[model samples]
Structures are given as C-alpha cells and as structure tokens.
Target chain A: MATNITYHPSPVTPTVRSSLRRQQGLTIWLTGLSASGKSTIAVALEQALLRKPYNLSAYRLDGDNIRFGLNKDLGFSPKDREENIRRIAEVAKLFADSCTIAITSFISPYRADRDLARQLHHAERPGGEPGVPFVEIWIDVPVEVAEKRDPKGLYKKAREGKIPEFTGISAPYEEPLKPEIHIRSDQTSVEDSVKIIVGYLEEKGYLSAPPEVNEV
Target chain B: MATNITYHPSPVTPTVRSSLRRQQGLTIWLTGLSASGKSTIAVALEQALLRKPYNLSAYRLDGDNIRFGLNKDLGFSPKDREENIRRIAEVAKLFADSCTIAITSFISPYRADRDLARQLHHAERPGGEPGVPFVEIWIDVPVEVAEKRDPKGLYKKAREGKIPEFTGISAPYEEPLKPEIHIRSDQTSVEDSVKIIVGYLEEKGYLSAPPEVNEV
Candidate 1:
C-alpha cells in the first residue's frame, strides 16, 4: 500500500480526458523479428501524424529508445522480457489515458504477451464493449530477409555466437494469428506502411474531428 | 539480447520535441506524509496549467492510479517501494520526453529513492550539463495534522496495528533536505500552493513564451 496515499475522487474519466485532447488515446503496437522495419515505419508515422490537422501528439516508444532508459535494468531473459513488455504496455496505457497516440516498436515474439497487452488496452468503459484502440501491426518479414537486411550486423553476431538467445536465430519468434494490421515489411515501403496506418487511424475516428464553430 | 538491435540515430531532440508542444517537459515530484494534500494540490495545479495559453498538457500519476496498472505486481516492501518509484520516474521521464507536464503524487518517504529519481531525470544532455527539469515539491505536513485530516481511515488502521510499516506511524518518513518547492500543506491554501508552483514555472521558462510576429 502507498504510505501516505489518500484516496481522492477520480478526477476526469478517460472519456473526459479524451474529449479534452479532442482525440482518442491509441496504441499502435508494432511487433516482428528484429530488423523488420518496425522502427523505421514508426518514425515516419510520427512525422505524418504531426503534419495532420489533429490535436494528436504522436510519441514512439521503440525497443532501442526504451532499452537505454526505462528498461535499462532489465536483461534479455524470458522473465525479464515479459516484464519489459508489461512495463511498456503500462506506459503506453498511461499515454493513452492522456489521449496521446503511442507507437511501440518491439520484437515481442510472444502470442500470449501480445494478447495480454490487447486486453489491457481494450478494457471497456461503463457501457462500452471496447475501451482504447490497440492496433497490433505485425511487421511480417522472413528470417532470411531480416538477416539479409540486418542494419547492425546483430544477425551476424548471433551466428558467430557473440550474442545468445537472439530471436529468430536462437530463440523462437511467435507470429500473430489475428493481428489488427499485417504489414509485409519486406515487400512494403516504409512510406506505404505509414500510409496504411495513418489511413486506418483516420477511418476509425481516432484522429480528432474538426473544431465546431461555437457549438456551445 | 535484443535481436538485431542497432544504434539508430535519434529522430528528435528534447528541444525540438518541446518546441512542438510549446512547453517544457517538466516533472513535479510531490513527496510528503500520507494525507498531506499532495494529490489535491497536484489536481488543482494541473487544472490551472490547462487554463493557461501555453500548450502544456498536464498529466498526473498518483499512487492509486498507478498501483493497479503499472505497479500492480509490486508490494509495499522496502525493495518493492524502490522499484515502484524507479518505474514511476521512468514513465514520468517518458512523458517529459514528450514535453508534457507530468505531476507525480506519491508518498515517497525515502530520501534515497527520491534521490535516485532526481538522478534519473537529471542525466546530462549532449553538450549540456543537465537535461530535463525535475521540480521536487515537498508537501510538508505534521503527522498530527495529517492524521486529523485523514479522509480515509488509514491513520486509524495504522494506529490499531491493522497496517504494518506505515510511514509516520511504524516506518520513518525521510524528509528531503533541499527541494525545489516546499509547501507547508498544513498552513497554505491549495490555491496558493498552485500559484507558487505556476509562478516558479514562469520564472524558470517551463511555460511557453509569447508568440512571435514573423518567425518561421
């Protein structure tokens, strides 16, 4: 229990918070094998979202960016990986609560963990069925293709036994069965992938509506 | 190890990110005895900031809200408390990265834990001495006063031995020697406390400046 915690009234429900931001809190979860173009697409998507006429402030939380800071204490063990994803999901939910679009680029090669994240973000409101939008984008790329396009030579390092339990090389990579969006990262350009995502957000009304003229 | 993890260039710096929001990413860390009016003051401060012209989107991370979500697995043990504060600081830093005013209301009774938070937020920037603006606000209140004002029955529970290791009752509350803002919650009005904070932000350049006439 919190030592000095006083249970005050819950200020501003998620609905009210979202209304203030004029946008829905969203999590675009990008998962695939390493070097699968997730982060690249995420970077472009952030810029694209900012260019749009929405109040949405897009924030990308990628594996590299997070590893050096939030999850620096964690290692690559199975338990640690689970904890890492859990923490990241929690932070994404926080951003969602604030009505910000959080893009997470992680090689979360586990089915159950991804489902757990979906459950966390898909929590329902008082009368609603689904709560926040959790768009799981599977950046599908074959191991051969990813290894060939390895930007950091980590695949080479894994093959040389310099790294251990490297996903798709030593550890297993679980593919998603019913992902919200399936991007063939090996085939699709980064720009096209971002277009598909931004278009989906627009079609789904996650982006803010145009301001009304003195509706009050 | 992260599979094929590569050192990618940073997409945006903190300066550039804050420019987009038209505000600085600030963390107001509130620490005090339980029932010391920390959450109340934080709530009022957030509302006050939103009413301003700056693009400051204020978000609060209280112990109650975060306990069930991010730190649900954590307990109230000494070690768990440290982990809890560490994770909260990391999330607050993430919010700061996005240029939001993140107000953390916790009964962080340990000086070491709070100092760790300060260090995490005070990491040096490239070619700079320090990075983010971490404003530690000490919500000081006497144990007698806080016990009298306990809206909930927590103090009574602690008194009756229903709760163990309760700060100011069983455990010690290590007060900060030097904090950015020291609010005597027992004596000051909630409105006045917020005014002191907002005034400090204006003087410290956390709030946005006036709009320029012809600057691209």
Candidate 2:
C-alpha cells in the first residue's frame, strides 16, 4: 500500500492537450552509427516539418546538443551511456506529453538501450493507457561510408585508437532488427530521407488536421 | 584534434523556435514543503495560463507524476534526490527550448541543486547566448501548517518514522535565498495563488500575446 504512489494530473488528457496545441505528439527516434548522418537528417526533417502548413511544431533533441546539457554529467562509459539514453527517452516522453513533436537523434548503439527507449514511450503515462507514438528510424550506412563522410574526423580518431569505446570501432554498435524506417544516409539525400519519414508520419495519420487552425 | 567532436544543427536558435512556435518559453519552478499545495497551485496556474490569449502552451511537471516515469529509477536518498532534481531541471530546459511554458512542482529541499538548475537554464545553449527565463516561485508554508494539512498523509508517515529522509521532517529544507515570486500557500487559496503567479508572468513580459484560443 505504501509503495503504491498514484499520479493525479489535471483533467487535461493528451487528446485535450493535442487539440489545444493543434498538433499530435510523436517521438521520432533516430538511431545509427556515428557520422552516419543521423543529426543531419534530423535537422532536415525538422525544417521540413516546420515548413508544413499544419498546426505542428517539431522539437529536435540532438545527441550532441543533449550531451552538453541533460547528459552533461554522463560519460562515454557503458553504464553512463545507458543512463544517458534512458534520460533522453524520459525527456522525449515529457516533450510528447506537451503535444510537441519530439525529434531525437542519437547513436544509441545498443539494441537493449534502444528497445528500452521504445518501451518507455509505449507505456509512459501513469496508468499506461494511451502510449505515445514512437517512430524509430535507422540511418543505415556502412562503416566505410560513415568514415569517409566523417566531418568531425571521429572515424579516423576512433580507428587510430584515440577515442576509446567509440561506436563501430571499440564499442559495439548493435543495429536495429526492424526499424520503422530504414535508409542509407550515404545513398539517400537528406531531403529524400526527410521526405520518406514525413510520408510515414502522414501515412500514419499524424497529419490528420487542418492548417494552422485553433478549436475552442 | 581527434578529441574534438562537432555538433551541426540547424541555424535556428531558441528565439526562432519560440517565434515559430508563437510563444515565449518560461520555467516557473514551484518549491515548497510536502502537502504545502504546490501541485494544487501549479494546476490552477496551468488552467489560468490555458485561458490566456497567447499561443503559449503551459505544461505541468508534477513531482508525483514525474516520479512514476522519468525519476522512477531514483529514490529518496540525498544523492538520488539531487540527481532527481537535476534530471527534472534538464527536462524543463528541453520543454522550454520547445517554446512551452514549463510549470514544475517539487520540494527541492537543496539550495545548491536549485541553484545548479538555475545556472543550467541561464547557460543552456551551446553558444551560451540568451538563456531561457527561469522564475523560481517559493510556495512558502510553515512546517506546522503543512503537517496539519497533510493531504497524502505523508507528514503523518514521516512523523511516525515510517518514511525517513522526509523534507521538513527528518530531512532539512534549505529555503531559497531570494526567489522571484514568494507566496504563502497555507494562507492563500489555490486560485489566488495561481492569480498571483499569472500576474507575475504578465508583469515579467511573458504574456506577450492575446488571450485563450484553442486551435483545431
């Protein structure tokens, strides 16, 4: 009995909040290898979503951007990485709860970690009735391709044994078995990748609303 | 250098996100004792804010609600409490970055932790330019009054030695040195408290647009 802590939020449900904000909340979780163009595609997708006439606001949570703030205390250790992923998942849930489309770009290398993130979104609420819609997109690219496109030169460093525990180098980068959307960043243009993902969102009925209108 | 890592996001800044979202981001942190009506006042404030004409969408982050999801891994220990507050603060920053007015209710009994949160907000972005506005609201309620008005019977449990490390009971509560808005929750009605907070927000130039309009 003592262990049962109930959460009583205001009568405002996600549906109500969604109506008020004129947008449906969804989490676009992008996972892939380092330098595989996750952040780039995410940015393109965010810009594309912003250009839409619908009443939607997509918020981006770049892995690099978050490392400087939310995951600031965390390191590159396995345990720290798990905690970092967990915290990001929680933050994404909170953002979705506010009826804002959450776009998260991270190199969540471990399958277990990414699965945990999905599970968190699946049953985020107190009683776990209405789960948040999570779209896990895999930016698939070969290590060689990623290394060639390494703007940060991280691939060369990881190969030179400079950065330990680097994904696709020292640490293992577990690939997603069946992602919602799979695309090779090397082959596909950022615009095409964003288009594909936005098409998925639209097909899933997330864009089922009028343009820039409010309901009382 | 091999040790260097670069993060490339869109040129859009928080100001752009705020403008595009058509709302200014604000963080109203409500701190007080257990059963001191922080969550109640926060809910009322949320309702009041919802009635505003601006494009603002205020999201409530209740302690009880978050513990079931984001802070579920944490406990009531000192270290865990510190980490809990830190994580919540980070999430609030993310919410604010999305141009949502974030209302958080927590009994964050440590001044250092709260100060760290404030600093995190003031220096949130990578460039450290124009941080989000954070308003610390102290729901000042006497310990006797709080214990008398124990809605969840937490005070009784703490007094009976059933719940250790309770703020204002066994654990110490370090009050804010100078909070932006301070109100006695024990003496004030929830509606009145919400009105005072809304007035503070208006006075602080957070209410920059028209009153309530729900979009469909």
Candidate 3:
C-alpha cells in the first residue's frame, strides 16, 4: 500500500471543489428548434472555453451523447420526452456539481421542461448552500429560417408526415419568457454567438475562480 | 458581445479533453454488500485524488446522489434495479469521457449488471479510439461481519423482514471473478483501503498527465 498520505476528514463540497479545480461549475442550457445552430454554437463555445485565456473544463451534452447513450430507451412519446429532459437535467446538474461547465444543446422546446431543469440546478442544498448556476441560452431562430436551412432535413421529414410531433412542426415550442441569454441564430454567426455567451459568463463572474483557500 | 476571443473550430474529443484537463478520465466501480465501506473508501479516494501529489479531478456517485437524484423515478423491483445500474453506468461513462475520475459506490450485487457497466466503458468508440477505462474494485467483506456492524440498522431490518430483496440477505450477492482491485474491508482500515487504491492507480500510471500537446 501507499504511505505518507494524510486522509482529510471533511467532505468535498462545492466550495472546496471550486477552490481545488480553480473554476466554478455551471450549466449553459441551450434551447432551440432543430437547425437553429445550437449544436454548432455549443461546439464552438466548448472549444473556446477549453482553450486559453480561460482554460476552463467544459463539456457539451447533445443528441449524440444523450439520445444514443443515456436515453436510448426513451422514445418520442410525451411521457418519454419529459423523462428524457429530466434525465438530461439531472446529469447536467451532476456535472455542474462536479465543478465542470456543462453545456446542454437540445431542442428542449417545452417551457415547463426547461423550467424544471433550471429549478433542479437552483435548488437549495444542505446547510443552505447555494446551488450551481444555470444559464439558459435561447438559440432563437424563426421556424421559417430553420426549416429553410434544414441541415439534417428533419423539417422536411416532419413536413412530409414521416416524423410526427416534431418540435416546431406538428408540436408546440413554448418560447422562454426570461432566458438568461438570447441569441438570434439567423442574425448572428457561430463565433459571435459563442462570444456573446463567453461575455455573459465573464460579466457574471462565473468564469473565474474565487480566492484561494489554504485547505484543498 | 465580446472581443479579442478566437474561436477554434475543432470538436473537443476525448484526446483533446485529456490534453486540456491534464488528466485521463476513468470510472472506479465499487461493488459489494451493504456496509462494506464502499462509500467511505469512495469519499477518501475522491479527497486523495483532488489533493496535492495527485491533484486530479474526481467525483463520487452513491445513494446520496444517484438514488435520490437521477434515479429517483426508479424503485426496488428487479427491472428498476437493473435500470438503476444502467443509468449509473451511463452517467459514470459520461463523467469519465469528460476527463474526471468517477467513483461509483453501490452494492451492485449481480455480476451481469456489473459486467454490463464494464462493457459500456470498454466498448470501442468511433474512429478506432480506445474506450475509457473501467476499474472494478470489489469491497470484500463477509455478510455475517457486515450484519454484525449494521451501520444503518439495515441488517436488523433485513432479518426482521422490514426490507425485502436486501443484498446478502433476501437477494444474492455475486462476487467478481476478475476485479482489478479487491479490498477486504473487514480486515482493512478505511485509510489503508484508500491507500491500496491510490497505490494501484499510481502503479498503473493513472495519476499523472500525459505530455503536453501543442494544440489545446
């Protein structure tokens, strides 16, 4: 066995974790219709945050990871969709609690589902400790523009009646009344969209670490 | 928005993530009967990894986080138990892919459930990349000894028929045939258990960062 190691009795709380990692944990929830450039912007944002002059640990959760991995058992039924979002929100909260920037790119168009996600992140912890920050970024785009773009031809399939109950097509997308950040994807470039998010995080002091603690 | 920020176009793959975070992500899955000291060892291991000499990012997933948060919808039925383990494995894989050590503490009594978790981690990725490592640490302790300790009065409850399908009592506990690390918690102290794990990680070179890359 190993020797010369002292076992610290205290638990690793969020404050202690932030000090050790040199960064705060938060989730940047990106909601939009399909083809709204959410995934594109999310990719660029993750890259920018991982590189200097920030060098913060960041990860993006999207259809690729969630739909295929965690929620593969879930389908398009209303109940399944709600469960899908719930699992995503919980996973993102776990990531945030671990002191990593969690960026979730999803067509989480339902307002209540999105709200539940925000509430989970903002819930009070034991000892009245504040919860991890949740930043909602509405990747706004006119349905016409998103349909016209049709990068994945999902809108075409939806219109052809092949994919029923798709968001912004046969189903409803209740827009966010008070999202933390709003980006008109049809008007802004991907780089600019990322910059807007990075700017918001910086302005809100979520990008930097707090003063050092002697104890790790 | 923000100025002087350059957007790098490359997607943050596992290789890129490891280079940026200065650590490789892996899951340490601890399995045994209840009161086997898995949670205690997990907390100590997480603390040890986050401190100096290791300084790695690590998180623990146990009943406190898993049962109450992500898998709250689940129950104690056979199917629900399987789903519970599945979700935990998937989330642990995500954490590992993000370049953080994920320590999962559970009684995971069945061999098949634990094997499925290991396979998920060892499954090949796209582009011929190696999958994240899964280290199974079996916290070995005799059921009688665990029943004697009965930290939560769970054994008494189990014997009194208060709880059904309790591992090592009503249900079966399948021991691992080829676990990467095996700790006899009955014969070992918590500090020593943590040391044994740390020593194994150090011997395998899992504690250090790889050579720096030019690109982030």
DockQ in order: 0.44, 0.39, 0.26
Ranking by DockQ: 1, 2, 3
User: How does each model score on TM-score?
Assistant: 0.92, 0.92, 0.95
Residue B134 displacement in candidate 1 (angstroms):
0.6
Off by over 4 Å in 3: A1-10, B1-10
How high is the DockQ of candidate 1?
0.44
Candidate with best DockQ: 1
Sort by lDDT, top down from the best:
3, 1, 2
Q: Interface RMSD (C-alpha) of each candidate?
A: 3.1, 3.9, 12.4
lDDT of 3 by residue, B70-105 (tens): 888887777888998999999999999899999999
lDDT of 2: 0.80
Comparing 2 with 3 on lDDT, the higher-scoring candidate is 3
Q: Which candidate is the best by lDDT?
A: 3
Proportion of native contacts present in model 1: 0.32
Off by over 4 Å in 1: A1-7, A52-55, A125-130, A210-216, B1-6, B52-55, B126-130, B209-216
- In model 3, state the lDDT of residue B31: 96
Candidate 3 per-residue lDDT, tens place, A1-216, comes to 111112223478778888998889999999999889988999999989988899888988887777878898888877888888999999999999899999998888789999999999999764467998999999999999999998777789889998878889999998999999999999999989999999999999999887677666
Give one digit per residue, the lDDT tens place, for model 2 in B116-153. Answer: 88987888475544788899999999999999988788
| Candidate 2: chain B TM-score against the reference chain B | 0.91
